[model samples]
Target chain A: MNNLAVDLPGLQLKNPIMPASGCFGFGREYSEFYDLSKLGAIMMKAATGSERFGNATPRVAETASGMLNAIGLQNPGVESIIETEVSYLANYELPIIANIAGSSIEEYEKVAAAFNETDHVHALELNISCPNVKEGGIQFGTDPKMAANVTERVKKASNLPVYVKLSPNVSDIVAMATAVEAAGADGLSMINTLTGMQIHLPSKRPLLANQTGGLSGAAIKPVAIRMIYEVKQQVSIPIIGMGGITTSEDVLEFLLAGASAVAVGTANFQNPFICPELIDALPHTLKKYGFNTVQDAIGKGITV
Target chain B: MKKETMRIKSTKRIALDTVEMVLENNYMSQTAVPGQFLHLLVSGHTLRRPISIADVNKTEHTITILFKMLGSGTHDLASYQVGMTIDALGPSGNGFQLHNDNQSTILLIGGGIGVPPLYYLGKTLAQLDMHIISVLGFQTSKSVFYEEKFRALGETYIVTDDGSYGDQGFVTDVLHSVESFDRYYSCGPVPMLQAVTASLKDKPGYISLEERMGCGVGACFACVIPTDDAGGYKKICKDGPVFDAQEVSL
Candidate 1:
């Protein structure tokens, strides 16, 4: 058997296939389709400091090879997640990564501390980089200093391994990644959705209610690869590469580009069975590429 | 919902832009309810298009779905013919709540492509020996379909905006002419739903909303609608494509 196991910071995954946060909702939704325990890890949806209703109608619009979303961290609060979502997710014997977002550093600390008390949660993914929200999201991610500050605060508040999910909407993605790593982030999630907008030609107005949304899917795959490649070179911390990964080949590409693990985003919308499909196909794909272990393939495409 | 590989038995253009597809899937035909929709995986399309179950014939083991060629996905769906196998995940969403013993009249109001799901609903209600009155609206006479099928089931009314078919106005216009109904079921664009909800404020009614979705299974919060609930929002894919008209804020 090919070794698909990956030890990402504090947590060890059966394989490197995990669904991106906001794509997988507590793993129960997809559990109806297949066994959730088969997955390497379940990345819970973004849980804010308080319950958020999210953005208005027309939150998503399709673009060529991709889609845009302005969901704005629509989730039950951290307390609710700990009380409800966490207990529900505990039924599955899989590593659960609590993805938390906040409007301020204190909120981030509070959520991280709360999640730290939870037993089922294996790690915390600090979402300092969601572009859809108005108050707290992408602001911290774009700037290295603010990103470092939030990362430092959240890392201090929690005993669990914290992974900073970086934004691709910045001028220097490497700087942001490095900042988070320096701020004591145990790991890094390279490339959140790119900021984009679509206009309705007939109405002469923006398609999304938020006017702007984060672009994700096949269209942004190349961008994700570039960012992961850059960040992996700059920082020693492990990276979870995700953007528009769909096929097993895409997973191999991200792995080669130095993603210790890969998260499937918009592809989940296209196919709900994607995580398992990718997992099943990974062995064959790696064999075809003449690789013996998943670790051997990691950073193989990079010169460093 | 089960993911079934269904073979298309036939495809016919019922209207100018509308096409009726019959698939030989016994599983879906048996499990499908009135308000539930199927998520079809079209070739070359990234996201599956959520198409409502228009009619299901258990004896024939066939499921009929009506789709309008609005975009590339539907345009590609139009090219599919008999013998082609299509991947479909369905019988999803909470369907309309049917009152079996309620002797009061039930109003089924639909607009455009929204009119198809009502046909199956009307059929189900008819089987229960309930009174079903359907008010269907279309943009023009060319867009009108399933009128005969609905008419054969129960008291059916059709209206066209261009006045080429039945009544010369919206479905609500015909609804206004009707004296009363015990309950109302609606599926249409936002404007029509708003008008119908306003007109039937005092009555108990249900409305099925259509939104551009990500995952048709409620994981992605793409197809969420604001509701008069604690969560403040409900997923149109899961919590409902069909919701109590009064419960959801239009």
Candidate 2:
């Protein structure tokens, strides 16, 4: 039996491994690497109300065991994504989750409502946590009231289940998680990239064109696990955990820390085959840890 | 487009802070084109370093990469011994388009590390019997490599910032002396590319660009450059590491 299959709200994943949003880019680039069907689910890039050109050049900086990116939610807006990108993804058999972001509550609602017309989109990953964008993004994620307001409005506007991606730059992660859950969030994608910066010695200035970028990679794994562990005990909704997930062992660690499913982010850049490789390795790794199924391992490490 | 573990066949310092590495991989050697690059994984670094393909020998099943030891990632790549294998994904990005008119003259402009890809392009064009003229620039004489090889192909000019070798000044100084060419191709730093594009604005040409990238594939959107078209931008990793000289904003 394939013990890798996982079920989250509005998503029946073949496995617990999927490429995180922003990292996968609408599944077009990675489709050249391997079969998209091999993935558990596809988290499409963040779509706003209109086109976004994002940050200037030198948007990425490499750090130890990780990388920082200030991509600023660059996308072709919701309508174009639905007509071009989403329609292209509809050819695949797996579920597709649209990651929606915007500068204001009205824009978030408009983007969320727009996804309801798409035939293949199964859920919406509310991206109030993108640290790179200056106008919106992390501002909502860091505040509980703003986070819930966006969540409630998006939930009201869209027919699909909403998964609020939480930012780690907050003073209270549990409060942020519970607030969204109370506001009708069906699930949670916890621990978005931590805010970070790198210095270029020769230039004697910040490395990224944007002063700071969101940090993602193996360096943030422990932080993801800690947040998931804390939020799992407080909320009834499922958690889709991600942060520096690279290996099957890392997947199991996220599952053990209370993530119902895992998303591979920065590691996908390191190896394009990471998501499918993790899917193939998950069953064996699960057996090695004595778990018969993915559901059995969720929150196993969290004590009541 | 494919990921494979390519074995290091040889490694040697070709210039100041520059090392030439020849990696053995039948797939890459065959598929790699003139301006495409190899995204190499150096041990202990999360992101891979993208180095341009300097040469390819399909019969030997090897592709040569020339890069400067700029940071820890590239510094680690320079340390690998012969026979050791390193993971690489590539022959990535759009390569330079070759014009096959035998009677036409083509000019090649390259600066610093950017000079590597032009070597492969020059070699390809030389075989087609097209007239090739190369103007290569460096910081000093010590940083220059492939002067003799380029000279073997066609009329080659060398320039340095400090008058250490050949002409003293940028490649633009020599561009005027070359007289005329049907087309031009360039790969270098952005400022150098901008200057080259400006000087050769009347002639049709292609320019390969470089930027800090996350996913060497198009997914990350980390290496995008603005275009004059309605799409507003193009990903340097996917749409091109190479673009029409007149298309991009610079």
Candidate 3:
């Protein structure tokens, strides 16, 4: 009953449980199970200007507690997303955050400028963390300068809130977080998939065609929480946190780490009921901890 | 699995591997056709595992699933009880098409785990009045399966790489003696599939491929197959897990 509303800087959500890009697929298939309108919002898969074939075979390599994926950011292009996925989800009663990544700065700005007025999209998640692709994806996240430049251009070009999604496969995440924030990023979605791998061993070869992939699941929770906590100390903008979050307690950990909102990424692959369970678990857990709202949990245990 | 088309039914555990628990369920003993599959919701696993219909029985739910314990979800699924109930969505997918009424005899070859779909195929061929010859291949005798059941269907042969069970060599070696069949169908590992395609390049055949799929529908394009065209890519789930050998590159 308490206010679940979250101020995502330039955007507002009734709640903070949006689907991470890639896992939810613009929210249609999952809708077959339950009404998607009940959730906060849907983040579209990463898109570029042209259709990409993605990586080679065996994109997913399952590890003991997590999964590694080298999806190569294979998308149907920005125009296609606008026509197919965005058009459909925009009318679903929630803000659609169009996630985009490109090989260049111009490509980022181009997508931002166009989607700024397209459909019901209220925000743009500039993805600079996808490691599987060849172009401007990981390059932007690895360097603070490129990350800031991309953020600045997208921010200037976009009328909608620009949320820069950061990669965890870096030496210092706070550097990337601070650079993007200073470059006018309105919000931050921390921790895209961590680069990892698995092999058949017997085959004397790598498990995935790409050899390595981004790892996401319950195993990465500890690392994700630590990074979110570190970034929370440096950036004032809201931090979107996700890593192996299969239960509500996981959501609380992100909040306590100073995440303004939390996202359910790899867990969706584990179970479709994760979102509803999270929504219900949050209130009960909040009350259990003697808090009335999730905001009460943010930074509660963080030193900063 | 209804009274009209089905008669025999039973659920049995045939093998337990480090990777998965292979559970077999039987359905539609009378009317169950070849190239068809069933759905099984192994409890503890979030969604149902759509396994190829290994074999059939009319009186009970007929199917078999070899589940690999890759993560917590599938790992939990490996522990499904023998009698526990679970949700399912099947007999889905466009299974391999088998028409014995055709003029020429048919050749069915399968390797590794790809033999699941061939089980029903063999049974259906037995029901028809045609010369059905089969080559069931595996890595070794321990993992080798369905040779006896296949023998019950028609002229069956076996080839194992380890030479533990039958002929020492690949299934392609057994395929060498096949004079001619009007059609051929197979499912197996990628290398085995490539070998099949290469060996039968002069002949016509249909193949079923396995890829890491996101949405089992065309929407995600996660299961795309690279084609001869520079700009063309076919979706395995939608375009097919089954495709004309001539159409697929490998």
Candidate 4:
């Protein structure tokens, strides 16, 4: 009886693998590669109060075992997303988590409230940690008070569970986690990409058009595990860990570090079938580690 | 849009720093169309490099890709030998839309590495019995390739930045010399594409674009170009690597 299922605040996942927001893009494109129902949930691309063109061209640059992107939350406003993207995803049997982002608290509330119209969206991943945006993203994420304030407002606006995505750029990951948790965040999704840049030698300038972008890949895994371990001890809410997850072993490491489930990010670009692949491999890996189920493995690696 | 582990049937240098590698994959060779690209995963690299399909041979069960050693990833790809297998996501992107209507005469404008897909396009058009003409531009004679292949199809001209080749100038410089063309297709750097578009503003044309891509799929909006209408943008990976001449702003 190998059980891969894990229950989070608002998500009843069949397995512990889901595609991270921004990387999955509403589940339309990847739906071509594999069945959407095979995964536990789908974390959609960040949606705002209005449409955003995001950053200019040369938006992504490759680094060692990782990549940098300043996509700046490019999305077709929440209204359009609800009218089309969300409704389209409703056809899937799995849970749909809507990731909401904005330039202000009011915009966050508006975008959060907008998801109430869709019956298919089971949760809301509050994206206060998006490193690419200028005004709202990291500004809210880095400051404890601001992170709590946005969490509180969004919690009031939406019926779905709110999961605050923490940024690794902050000095104290636990402080940001506790603040959001106290403000009523149902769970935590850490860590959003670490702010980094790559310099192109020939051009004698930054590689990404936005100059600096969030770095995510194998290079950020250890940091993610450390943060999840630290924050899990300080906060009581479940943690949906992501950052440099590419293999089933990475998923188990995250679970042991106290993540309830895991999200696949940059690895989706490397292999579109990564989610299902991880889902299939997780049970065997868990058993090899002496765990009967995914839930049994959570926090096993953390010390009091 | 199939993912397959394609084996390299042969690998050789075609021009200066460019390498031509033919990969044997039955599904890809049979399904790939002109201007479609292969998002190949090179060992020791994070992101998969998107290389356009240079040509396809259904009978041989192989698809050819020509790439220049641009950086560490491509340089590593150039090192791969025959019989090696590479993971590929392919026939990706919206390829060129071919029509055998009254637009029988076609002009192909290519610059450097962008010349590969045009070769595939020229080959496909030639099979349709369409009259083809190609104007290829390179940095020098050493960088020029496929001149004879294009000439076998129809009238072909080679232009180089340095006066070591056919004509000393840009492709736009020789545009007026070609008698006439009912339609044109181009793939090159932004400046060259812009110049070609401006010179042939009234002509029906399609241009392939290049951008730094994340997931060579529509999932990531990394490779987007602004639409001409100024309303929104289109993804270069999904909406097109190929677009109508007047569709996108350079």
Candidate 5:
């Protein structure tokens, strides 16, 4: 058997197949289907400083190849996560990535600092790329300076590794990657959902109550590959590539395009067996490509 | 959640836009209950579509699902052949709470696609010796379905918007006439659920809600419904697709 272990900046995993935040809750929902300990890591849903109920009803809209969601980062606050969620997750022998986002830098630092106190948490995924909320989410993500500022604050506050999850809505994603890297982000999680909107013809209004949302699914794979390739050239930090990755081949595509790890985001909604299936398929895929280890596939597409 | 390759036993067009499909799955038939749903993976769709289990024949190991061709996913599901196999993940969600009280009368209300699960609920309750009163509403006469099936279990009331068949108005019209309903179970559009909640304020009611879900598990917060408490959200997929009527804000 080949070594599928992925060593990110401050975290190591048995494999590189983990569910993206917002798709996998605190890990209980998917645990019913299969044991979650088989994957690389579990990124808990994005939590805020305080509990958020999120937007009103009609928060999701199905698109041609993907779905649009304006979940508004509804969660049970950081305290609840540490006390209730993160503790329960401790039963499983798996790495946990606490995906944190807030409306302000202080809010971001507050959540990060809280997670930093917990030994159960392996890393903190700074979610500056969420496009659903009215404040602090995508605003910091779209601007390089603001993105760097949030990353800097989080890195200083948290003892755990900080991976800044970048948004795909910006015109120059490479610029965003570079900014966060320069600001001392430990690692990077690329390609958060793109901004999108859908409408119901009968009512002639938006399908989601939030009016616009973040689009994620197989439709965004090509774009994710492009951006990961672009950012891989600009930054030396290990990039965790996501957005529309469904298959082992898709994971290989991201790795070859320069992702150190690949996350199964929207695909988990389609198939609960995805992460395990991909993990099981990776060995055969590596052999098919004449590669011995997962590390060999990284940046295989980039040439001097 | 159990994943099974269930064979389609039969498919019949029961109404204008709705199709009733009975799938043969031994384990699911033995386990499924009312208010629970099945997440079906259509061959080409990226997300699984959550469909309610309309009926279950435990003896035959068959589960019936009623769905309308509202989108490409259901459209693809509508095209399945009898011998064809499809992947199903289910008997999921907290289904209707079936209490042990036997002497009290039970009321069930459903609208459109929401009517399916009520059939299963009524059937389950009937077996327990509970008197089931069902009020099923549709947009018009042509869309009405399962009247005979629901009638077999108990006293069934049918209402339509255009008065083409049964009562001349909404389910609320018939609901006003019926008294002494001890327990209430409802599943339908949000408006229908809201109206039902308003009428049954004095009774213990459980409402099954519908939302566009990403993962039909508690994982994705896509199918959240705001509750009466501030910043408190209940997941329709996990905490409920079935919620206490008084607890939900709608």
Candidate 6:
């Protein structure tokens, strides 16, 4: 009860836990397990300009410590979300971050503009990093100018807070992160899925229906943490970190990497009660580790 | 968003990649009819496994599920033995519906592992005073099972592609022999579903489709199929795993 709140720019979330998009589809399922209102916020599945059928079969392929998905952003389109899912999500009474994607910058603006009219939607998390689809994936994320352009467009068009979702498949995230920040992005979330592949060795063909996919799960934790630390140094904006978060211990790691908040992803598939358990375990770990607040633990171990 | 229709009472590994699990919960059992499926939360898998219930004993407080190890999750379930626990969320998707009071001939056709769910459906229909014609197809005789059990339900026929069993071809040939029946029920591969749809275009039939679903509920829009009956796409998880013959576009 002694102040566990984590603020992200203009928005105030009661806690630092939010479900990553695609992992938590509007919190309807999670509601069956626990009171979703207890969490800080929710990231609805990545929305797009039109309804997507997603990739073909075997969209998800498991690796050593993670899984890759080429789901191709399957959704009912943005207008449907505003017309359907948003009302149910708004019931959570916390910030509702809309994770959106598109084939072009104009499409991003269209998706963002739809949410701008809704008072309950706290922010627009532009997913420039998703590796699943054929259009505007790494194309918008890897290049500083492209990243800046999309961020600028959404910021210019959206009345809500804009958080640019960064991709990990880049060589220097610092450049991309810096570019988005300068483009008027309110906050930043990193790093979206890492592009990887799984080979069906017997057939000697790529396992995923789409040859390459975005890798996520416990495997990418280290790489994600490293990205958070590097970006924390270059950008002063709030950082919402997500990649392979499974437990409160992992949450503590993200906090220590200079993330203002953290998101729970792939772990939901492994355990439906992951968030509740982590919520129960988090504060205790913070005090035991000599930190008064979860925020104080942010970037505690990193020198750079 | 399928709820935990039941909870694990006992779980055991009976084979290399096979798990013999029993779940006990009435929310699922009381309304749990045959040919319906249950999605399993396999510990290490990225998602749940949509397994057809092998058998369910409501009075004894048990539902049986057999999971074949295909990947990490099933491999994890395969490692468990007696008294182990797992989560179950289902009795999901529409099961086969038979006219309870009608005295009619019932044709039950299934293929390979698809034969499991029909065992229960055939058993349920046998309760009524009716004639049941069962035709099962498998790749080989070794893979064929429950023939005697299904025979107890009514008349049973077996077919294997290798000719190591009853008929030396697809089971559809034997099923076609019936020519006409009051009703037909089937569950199997897409081609088999397509075949059933094509063959029974002029007859009364019910077909269940199995699609890789996301939420196992109507929400995700992941398991959508063209509806010949409804016009728009219908969600297989909620609207059906079972569909009215004329409703599904092959």
lDDT tens readout by residue for model 3, B164-200: 8889999888887877777788888888889888988
lDDT per residue (tens digit) for residues A1-304 in model 1? 5399998887789999999999888877898889988888988999988899888878888888888999889988989989998999899878999999999999999999999998989999989889998998788988899989999888889899999999888878888888888889999987789999999887899989999999999999999999999888888999999988999999999999999999988888777889999999999999999988798899999996
Where does candidate 1 clash, by residue pair? none
Best by DockQ: 4
* Estimated TM-score for each candidate: 0.97, 0.99, 0.85, 0.99, 0.97, 0.91
Better of 2 and 4 by DockQ: 4
Rank candidates, lDDT, best first: 4, 2, 5, 1, 6, 3
DockQ of 4: 0.88
**lDDT accuracy of residue A284 in candidate 6:** 86
Query: Which CAPRI category fits model 5?
Result: medium
TM-score of chain B of each: 0.96, 0.98, 0.80, 0.98, 0.97, 0.88
Error of 3 at A289 (Å): 2.2
The lowest-lDDT stretch of 10 consecutive residues in candidate 2 chain A is A1-10
Which digits, one per residue and each the tens of the lDDT, describe model 2 over residues A127-156? 999999889998999899999999999999
DockQ per candidate, 2 decimals: 0.68, 0.86, 0.24, 0.88, 0.78, 0.31
Model 4's TM-score against the true structure? 0.99
Between which residue pairs do clashes occur in model 2?
A217-A244
Q: What share of the true interface contacts does each candidate keep?
A: 0.58, 0.92, 0.11, 0.91, 0.82, 0.14
Per-residue accuracy of model 5 over A1-304 as CA lDDT, tens digit each: 5479888877788899899998888888788878988879999999899988888768888888898998889898999999999999999888999999999999999999999999899999999988988988989999999999999999999889999999999898989999999999888998899899998997999989999998999999999999999989989999999989888899999999999998898888878888999999999998898888999999998875
Better of 4 and 6 by lDDT: 4
Worst 10 residues of 3 chain B by lDDT: B1-10
The collision pairs in model 6 are A256-A299
Candidate 3, position B94, lDDT: 62
* Model 4 agreement with the true structure over A1-304: per-residue lDDT tens digits: 5399888887999998999999989889998989998989999999999989898879999998899999989999999999999889888889999999999999999999989767889999999999999999889999999999999999999889999999999899888999999999999999999999889999999988999999999999999999999998998899999989988999999999999999999999999999999988888898898999999999999878
Error of 3 at A111 (Å): 1.9
